[model samples]
Target chain A: MLKDKKNYKLIVVEDNIGDFILFEEYLNEKIENPTLFHFERFKDLNDFQDKITPDFDIIFLDLSLPDKNGLDLIIEVQKISKQIPIIVLTGYSDESFATTSLALGISDYLLKDDLNSTTLYKSIIYNIERNKNLVKIRESEQLYSDLFQLSPLPICVYDIETLLFIDVNEAAVNLYGHSHSEFLNLKVDDIFHDEEIDKTEEIASKIMTHKKKNGEIIFVDSRSNTITFNGKKAKIILSNDITKSLNHIREIELQNQKLKEIAWKQSHIVRVPLSQILGLTQLILDDKETTQETKELIIILNNSAKELDKIIQEIITKSKEISLNE
Target chain B: MKHLFIIDDDAVSVLILKKMLSNADFLETPMVFYNGNEALNFFSKNYTSVDTYCVFLDINMPVMNGWEFLDNIQTTIHPNNFMVYLLTSSTSEYEKSKSNDYHCIKKFISKPISKEILNEIKEVFNSI
Candidate 1:
């Protein structure tokens, strides 16, 4: 199939001029308009550093360069070829050195004896594509790690079967009063108050009290989800500290209890005196009273006492309803 | 006619009730006790038939309250023979609902009892 006309930039960091020509010959067979930049030594590449833009797709590094060689050369080349794929070309067929060179971030280790158009062409295409995928994977991993570590709320991953914490973010270490290593040694139950687990559903998120490593119990609204962590079934817990809010609710409840007690006393204590006033007035009205003026005064006194009683009753009833609702 | 009893600590309440019953011309004189303990002592000695006695019970006395009196009375005699009316200062809904649990308690009346209510109580006893 005919491919799209694309400009390909390549760098050959080989000191041997004959090997550089052989690489160009192989690359020319597969690629069209391959811009080749040849640097004979590590010092030569250092001088060309300012020109080392990201436009270069791949770097063909000769391990035995004039200034640098072996693993040292591969590391130095990596500094300039950030996202570019680097293929190590060597006259030696030493498998151990090639393995070591690959470990130092060289994309592929190619032998000079196996230099053919098809072999070089395949290595270039495969390593470039593979490097692209590796870069993408690293970026996504960095994004996830940044989100986890920099979150304001505490977050942790714990092995579901053992309940042991697999990982804890910075906020979790601060909130739970445990170092990362200390948290890894603890189970989920160890970080929670006994009553907290009793009130919480095993599979659902809830608000409950948690015990820190230093023995301080705090309220936290937490969510837990089943997840896979390093190939093990684990749970991710996200928690927001709610101790202050819970304390506020407790304080309000205490105030409400005192209010209820006062309302209770109003129902009983206040009515005692009021009942006496009513009884005394009734006795006066029944008395073969001596005068009409005395009767009228008693009638007014009785009505006032009844009105006061009604007001106290209304207050007590309303408060009782409030307490009952709670 | 059934014998009437008033168990109360307050002097004015007992005095007012006496005058009201008299104004209504109730036949039997009500036997009065200052506290629930005194009423319980009287019932322990004199309790013979529930149908023959009617009590106007009060709460909040020094020796024993109305609830204790009710509890004590139930243990000593048959629950059906006596008719109890709670006549007290408490207008609390809690106490009112609690009074329903006692089958022997025929009515709950918050004081002060009028002559009309006294006549009505007399008519109820007459009908029974």
Candidate 2:
């Protein structure tokens, strides 16, 4: 009663009519209105491959076909089936050959004599579910692989014990000036500066010096973590080049130091004589014995000195502002 | 008795201060020293708890600067007996703020010392 409610789309590739009919009866017994496409020869299946779509749920592949048989038939059918689960149907009870077919990516291998509706139905359901999970796992693996390969920052995987470079992304290849194969041959210590190799364990998230293939030295902010890569204990390092930024900061500091020196000179040295001039002029104007004309001229001189002091003060303030900005 | 002292390297600055003090009609004629070491020597010999001493001190001198003078005399001088006026041509906020560290330093005066500043100093001495 439960089988009558379901409809299954199936493809059968068998040269034997009796075997094909037997498969059809077994499928119909389990799935009441099963949609079957029976191809008597492998050539006929190959010819109709262009019309094959993912709508076909399960493929019942005959291990022995008139035009193609054994491993060749399985491989060709798999090419057409794509994501669809294939159950190898055979008359022989060869256990070793069954294991080999499964290794070749067949979803399941079943003997034709032992094949009943219940057995066929169970095999179809199990293989389809397993193939769906396999597809999902493959997709997840591809996504992770893409992330590693396409990242902009230079990344490398090295074996923890030997420190040999196991894998490197395209960015790492470009940055280190080493080809992919060349990097594999070199150890992590080879890229590090001779002095820095001794301190590699303490290199996480710290700026360290590295050497390129051409012997050019670079500063990099390195971060790393342990990972089991290809069954080997390894460490993955992501190196961010910080040479330009560090140099930029140093340049700014030097400029600030120069500015501070200039400010000090302005405040201490330049203002001394100016203050004397102001003092001298004030004393002259205050002198009771000095003539009126001389007194007027001294007032003008004092005002000019005051103006000059104001300009010097402005210069000191501006220099401080510039240094602060840096 | 009240005593006035001018501790500065520049002769012209000392002359200007002395003239300004005279014009302000200060009674005591100030003693002059070229540097902090000279002033420190004078204080070591002449220091008395009874006498009120007002010092016009300049910061950037050749030997023993104003800071050195303050550090040398900080323990010896009583705050009530001595009043230090920091007179400097250096327009530095850092030096002004740094002057606050000395308890003997009463006021920071930017040079050249004006008639108003002299009158203010005279008032502090007059009050004592």
DockQ of each: 0.59, 0.59
TM-score of chain B of 2: 0.97
Q: How many residue pairs clash (N, CA or C atoms closer than 3 angstroms) in each of the candidate models, in the order given?
A: 2, 0
Model 2 over residues A185-232: C-alpha lDDT tens digits?
999988888554542353468678888899999999998888899999
Shift of residue B100 alpha carbon in model 2, Å: 12
Candidate 1: clashing pairs of residues: B50-B81, B50-B82
User: Residue-wise lDDT of candidate 1 within B10-45, one digit each (tens)?
Assistant: 887888788778777778899999999999999999
Off by over 4 Å in 2: A1-4, A40-55, A66-69, A93-95, A143-154, A174-179, A195-204, A213-216, A269-273, A276-280, A283-301, A314-326, B1-89, B93-128
**lDDT score of residue A138 within candidate 2:** 92
- Give TM-scores for every candidate, taking all chains together and pairing residue i with residue i: 0.75, 0.65
Model 1 agreement with the true structure over A33-150: per-residue lDDT tens digits: 6888899999888788778886678888888877888777777778877668888887766666987877777789789988898888788778878988998999999999989988
Query: How does model 2 score by TM-score?
Result: 0.65
Best prediction by lDDT: 2
Candidate 1 Cα lDDT to native: 0.84
